[model samples]
Target chain A: MSISLPKAFNEFDEARQKGFIDVKELKEKGKNIVGTYCVFTPWEIILAADAIPISLCAMSDEPIPEAEKHLPRNLCPLIKSSYGFAITDTCPYFYFSDLIVGETTCDGKKKMYEYMNDIKPVHVMQLPQTTIGDDSYNLWRNEMVVLKERIEKEFNVEITDENLKQAIKARNEERRMLKKFYELGTLCPPPITGLEILKVLYGATFKTDKNEQNQTIDNMIKSVMEEYNNGVRKVSEDAPRILITGCPTGGATEKVIQIIEENGGAVVCFENCTGVKGNDTLVNEDIDPIDALTDKYLNVACSCISPNDNRIELLDRLVDEYKVDGVVDIVLQACHTYNVETYRIKKFLNENKNIPYMSIETDYSKSDIGQLQTRISAFIEML
Target chain B: MSISLPKAFNEFDEARQKGFIDVKELKEKGKNIVGTYCVFTPWEIILAADAIPISLCAMSDEPIPEAEKHLPRNLCPLIKSSYGFAITDTCPYFYFSDLIVGETTCDGKKKMYEYMNDIKPVHVMQLPQTTIGDDSYNLWRNEMVVLKERIEKEFNVEITDENLKQAIKARNEERRMLKKFYELGTLCPPPITGLEILKVLYGATFKTDKNEQNQTIDNMIKSVMEEYNNGVRKVSEDAPRILITGCPTGGATEKVIQIIEENGGAVVCFENCTGVKGNDTLVNEDIDPIDALTDKYLNVACSCISPNDNRIELLDRLVDEYKVDGVVDIVLQACHTYNVETYRIKKFLNENKNIPYMSIETDYSKSDIGQLQTRISAFIEML
Candidate 1:
């Protein structure tokens, strides 16, 4: 059963054009809404607090004049995008209801939040920059506890263990299906089409309905298996397998995969927030769901969203699991946190794993496809 | 007339072996010492405080093992150096200082202050990352006032306006003479040699007696003028005039200047905390000296210290005053603050003026000669 993506909430472009769940309607229905920059780690719980529909306000849209009011022009594009949304009447349908939240992914984001909150009061917390280390993990956990209390104080909504558990259950189901999608990609010659995987993955996170998303993912998985069984997919036995690391993991990531494929390579696995995180699994279903969800989300930590911990292990696991022959660390300029950490990853891989690694730097205008193509060709040839 | 740099402190290698100031002696002498890293705008005033010595703890020394205990490996080197001195007996003089002051130069330095304050009590203040607007300048001014009070409270010393004026007078003389030396470098077939000027510049800063240092500078200037009048100097007329900008205008800066000169370019002027700032005239000598110092220092800010309101103007002035042909922005890899501001300077120069600019990123390693040479040669050829 191949389920179709719901027309209401599809791709980011479509959502941007069609407008997200209407703020006015939610206001009329007495549903409070809060806006955020990125879909953060503790997002499901934030959304589940009956605090209105939590929407991602990616700060990379057209420049907003109002953002320049609060932030310097050199600030990260994501910050500018958020400011643009905040000032513009574009999201009049989305309730600009309660408080906004900012997470520490990079210094730019962190500084932007500081400047933003100074202008307009927003509840802010510093997330762990890395996903590794018990101290870092606990710092985030403690922050979440404080954050939960702050949210409760602001919205006057009680977020009990039961409500959080329900949210985690939904998120975990989405994660499982997303994981299945990733496994399909790891299959020799990749049974599922990259296009189908992109749509299914995108829908898993952006879809308003959890059950429908799960259904869509299941159908996509079944169709991929059927296609594999029918032997209709193009299989490249000699193609070098690779894993793409860093941000811009949506359609931007596909470009990287396409480049690799064009250079006689195949992207077998992706460990990015926007890539396969929708398929992340639940951690210890028998345990407290909040902890489980935190663990699961933490385990699927996005390299682009925050500084990744143990990228060496992540890459090693991907290499072993997906039979990867090379790794491409695609980072962006102004995204210094990832850029610095990637060098360490490169050093580690070079010293320990004998893996061929190349780094690609992208800017807001990732329109330099020729440079990227040349780099990809060179990287593939080296591999 | 030339002041000989203490043989021990003549070169970085010798200084490393001779060791830094004795922090233990500083504590015993009852001299209120303020530990500072990089160059803060108000540090001159802090040093001017009665019986207080502002020990600039630029992170240019040996690998800071002690600082590495508390700070992450990738912290701003200056902060690490300060922390290293504070915890270790290596630089016992600066280590046992009465207080440590750190500013919000970058995220790492900001975090290091937090970490230090949390672990060991220290004074920390948020400084504006950029120096474009009045609010930013006023914030620094107010910070200077608060810092003044805080220093008084900690050291039990009255840091009067007179003392600050005296300090400024002495510092300005030092700066004026240094600028004069730089101006002489701009003379076609420069009258004074870079090595000789560097020795005197590095020596004059650490000299305890202010009047004697001025006398030495006067003598050096006279010698250079005499040499030029007689046409005895052999300076390169075809050399492109270069301006050095960055921190710790010491042996490393001198080395860079030598490299540029050897590569057929001349370091005609330097816009750095230690190089250009000592000459910033006291705005109101009759008024409150501390306030005058604050206003004056803030007026001519160094990118390595604080953001200045007139950075582009500063560049233009250097271009006009010293007749510089190019700007060489030298900053270390982890120097986030200087790196960002240098980029700003580069962009500003590119837009406002046709002066060629080159940015050199180093890790304070002496072995970076190859990288420095390549960039300098290319830049000189372009000029």
Candidate 2:
């Protein structure tokens, strides 16, 4: 489902740019394949299991008439869309479907694991819905090891420690490169727009070759920074300082940034699960690489899955570091993690710091543009 | 604690209004009330049997250091204020040495009940959080009856079936008056400002006497309807229609309405657990009155307890009746219920209807108004 739909929705620009490994061709490449679902963690290692490809379900337009037929309409849309895609054989390669991973951020997603397990082979992991401490991260690290083991056994493959270390190295290298891309944002003119950074980040995830992803990011970052250094697109210093964090705002990202800038605010800093949560941190290699990788992943764990994920702290830090006047927690429809975090962020800001924090959760659609503008205008005027 | 706290913080609106029920004068009043606790159901019959005053723990500005110590820093301020009033003994009427009552809602509130029961004598009733079907309604109805019997036995008072019916009538009448107030919103000019309605509705919950509440509401509703009929606040016809729902948006309600109007959108309808979830459908007198009342309460059950209690049909009905082009599901801080419901509402709107719905969660303060306004404006534009 992940393979075909990313193509159908044109979700992966990097993958297409790099070159294609068609599902049929990829299938011809190996057997005893294994599959798993993922959101935050890298798919590179899962593929390196020398098993089948592990796909990240980034949401695509596909029908799930069968899953939707039995499930209540109120269930999360991603689950519905995945089930819809699965049943239709959109990704016919998913037939083996060794395992499915799920998290518990909101009730709907919590139920998604339980609901899907009834229909097919499944593996469920309870992700932390709140950012607490190091507890959730450590727990998830242990669970990931177990999940990896289960995948190895299912595929009848030997997942050697050395191979696992290599996978960790590859993922860390990707993170470093992505961080370099984001660092360009610090430039006076921000050589790269937020969208440019987002595109390269998302592109890296779908592309299998780690070295190619690093090169693309390094090149883009260099090019953009050079342009900004040469006095290209200039960013005003007196613009309204804004902090952007939480889940995907979809296409609304540009609209949000535009609205903020128009209303005397500039999105100077952002902490989106997609944009920065997994970008800045690197896996430690000195210790047991597995535990080191786990520790690193835990330290920089993104997604709504981590219980210890304190979005308020992220916003607070951004506000302090960037001199942000306001913080906006933009959430996607059917994303439970951010919805739950929205309240905590608002409370912490209102009670402790008196910082203005606003939450906006929506489905990515072009129609909501005007409503979004008025709200932004009013919020800015009040500020 | 309730009595002592009100005295401490010195907010006497409750004490003065409950009619001179002073802690110092308790001995003179000749009531052997050792302690007091607030209740929703007829648990009072049980407290009375046990020779205790189940004081409806009305909102009080009392200081409760103990409660503040136990609760999370991010819990609802309103709830914290209530607890504060309890411990300070300024509202020293509550027989804290005897009992208290609590219902399940958000994780914070749920944990609050767990803490209260362990630290103090507490009577807990699992309140229905959602009203979806007749079976669930009947289940709550049965629970209410069992509760009444238990109360009678505990208090050692012969609460005859007749007394139970009267209590039921009192609550039903309270609801009916509240419904009448809500109906006034249907008028062309909406008899009163949205803020006025919210103030009155939340204010009335602390009042135990049915007659006084009904009288106040009846007058307010009448005046509002009269003003609407007299064409007091009608607006232009091109305004975009909006249906606002979910948990309370607090002060954001007015800002939302103002932004919508300014952006050529009209907030024609609103349905919130705090505002309308308690304004249940009319009771059927022909049926067992107590049973009927229970069902009614469960029918409009607030989505503050669990996501399992969602009424998508009710939401659909609102969209149809109100001619809504968009929806905004506001999730208040520490409110897990509305946060969960926000996801469901978003998914439902996306797949089933064309209406654009945006979810916003708040901590009930003055910040984030700009972000909310932006989201609202974009939503209206889409519509």
Candidate 3:
């Protein structure tokens, strides 16, 4: 059965068609646009600094050719395409960005930021890899302070503790709404398809207005919950409930989701750097806002961190919560950290958790779609 | 003029001939042999626990084929060979190790440790990637504590503070002697060849007898200083004084050094992970030994760390102190961290110091020997 998207969801598509009309409108209204590469980039700080934060992670094959001129052909397609968008001037969000935020989450993106710096003002946030030490927390907090100072200096705005608290609250509400929206997937015959959820999550990255985004998420949640309560399922109940994990899969690289859905599998949850994992935790408001932000972000189980057992813990929690029958880990080409972590992930899933697992290594090209489909189909069959 | 080899140098070769006689003898004497991969693995802790610490970083092409059976073909040769040695039971040092220490310095090595675990008892140390944070220091110190406990449990020995202090002293003496030895290279027509220095450095990794090593170093230092005082240079003063940097170049991967020295360049200093940079700093004895060890190791400036400005600072000091003319950054294939940092290293050297820099990317294979020689020759010509 074909499902109709909500009006708010259609608005996002229309905005994309009109060259990200919302971002353009925000820029025209004298608001500073800050393009970010990872969720680790403090969006709350940008919001508090009276600037709009939009994720600039590209997922298109279109920009790879342009990006190859500046980068090695073997780099992650996400990085290459992102750089391509910047160099080729295909991304209006990047073109209109007053400042761009980059983090040292991975080497490929970290070095790519240097090149990105040539085209735009890039503020690099030096993220610490380990999360368990006081030194890491203090170092990360200091980095956040440095970032705040830079943002304030550039935007000429005071990001007071009160401002941060307000931003944190707004962001927390958005996260709560997102959490609720994802909960619908846990139902037998998930009410909302994985692709539909991806569209909403992807749209939130570029949407500047958190309140409007929350409202959109609420509407999506309402629609999905209604369907679930009415016993209207998007996919057959027997379809394999697959947990999607690994490197960030933005809107441009949702082929895995499409392939899974098309081949008798439904993605129940995403345990990746993007989507719910990025915004799952809320900043603790009781302590110093900076410390809270530092704690929350540092605890984010990015594979870039050593002893990333936290990621496995999160995956375990998600698997049980989403009732996942199998896991599909997609590692973008040249994403060394995620690629390496796949061994441990597979070991944990297959041996310990008794969940079926498959790792897919691919780039942002259509060449591997058929092969991926075959493998995914086999994985579903096993589940 | 040909330089006569020191008798002490012959002992290392003899030990190698006898299949790492020092390591074998230590094992025979009932001393627990702890094999390590990165400098980040605290040797002092192992020494404090009454265990002999030896580096297990392999740089041989022979075992790559064996390693490929368990690992991907595109992995770094160092990791592959290291694992190959473990799986194929080739290296005697690995065979004699009671426990192998692996640090998460890079993804390839980290994942390889999992496979190595199948063959031997592996203690994986979670290394922090940033040095700036209190959290990182605390995390690292705690890890050191954990390592100490593990060593103590395995060896049935209490590593007291006194023991740690004594270990630190012995290790510091080795560093000082090594430092003095490297200092001789600063002289015009440097007193020693880079290859000779590499031999001494590589030997130290597995040689547990600190006093003997120190004595050997003292004799070498005295000989080098005598040559320096006599105005007898190892290489012509006109030979390009080059500094080697980037990934650790163990004894098995000394091709770059040989290529540089054979072609008109004398390596005045090594700023890489394996040489002086790895053991340059002495742990502060005044403070808590664990804290001091944490500080020293964290400051090692491995490219694995984010915002690795310490590496640049160290390079600056080495260049000025050694009176270096150019830099040759050798990055092993599939070693992503150091590979990415080359861009920044090149940018920093060219823009800030005006130093001529060249990056050589190769594996532990003879295929690239001619290409590396040509590049080194060209780099020396430019200098």
Per-prediction DockQ: 0.05, 0.03, 0.26
**What TM-score do all the candidates reach, one by one?**
0.55, 0.50, 0.83
Q: What's the C-alpha lDDT at position B321 in model 1? A: 74
DockQ: the better of candidates 2 and 3:
3
lDDT (0 to 1) per candidate: 0.60, 0.54, 0.81
Docking class of 3: acceptable
lDDT of 2 by residue, A1-383 (tens): 01232232244344533323544455566643334444444343465576444443434534534555644443344555556656665554355455565543344444444445555666554343223334445555655676677667766666677877787777777777777666655544354444444555555554555676576556555555565556766456555556677664333245676666767766656676555665556666677766765555445444433333334456566566556667777765545444544655677777777777776654434467788788877776666
User: Which scores greater on lDDT, model 2 or model 3?
Assistant: 3
The TM-score of candidate 3 is 0.83
Q: List the candidates ranked by DockQ, beginning with the highest.
A: 3, 1, 2
TM-score of chain B of each: 0.81, 0.71, 0.96
Q: What local lDDT score does residue B212 receive in model 1, on the 0 to 100 scale?
A: 62
Candidate 1 lDDT, tens digit per residue, B1-383? 43333332244233333223533454566666666654454655666675444444553547466666555455455667666655564555455556777765555555455445543457765454444445445556666777788888877778777667777666666566667665676576667555555556555544444566566556666765765686775667777778777655564445577788888887776676656644534356566665675566556565433324355566777777777788888775556445545646776777778777887766544788887888788899999
Model 2 chain B lowest lDDT segment of ten: B1-10
Tens digit of lDDT per residue, candidate 2, span B300-332?
545542334335777777777666678877655
CAPRI verdict on model 2? incorrect
How would you encode candidate 3's per-residue C-alpha lDDT over A1-383 as one tens digit per residue? 22355665666544444548878888889999889988787788988887888878897889899887667666789998999999999999999999999987777787777678889999888776657556567667888999999999999899999999888888888888877877777787788788777776776666766787777677667766666777876789898898999988865568889999999889889887656677678888788888888888888888877668788898888889899999999899878778867878998998889999988988988899889888988888888
Per-candidate Cα RMSD to the true structure, in Å, reads: 11.5, 15.0, 4.6
Docking class of 1: incorrect
Residue A225 shift from truth in candidate 1, angstroms: 2.2
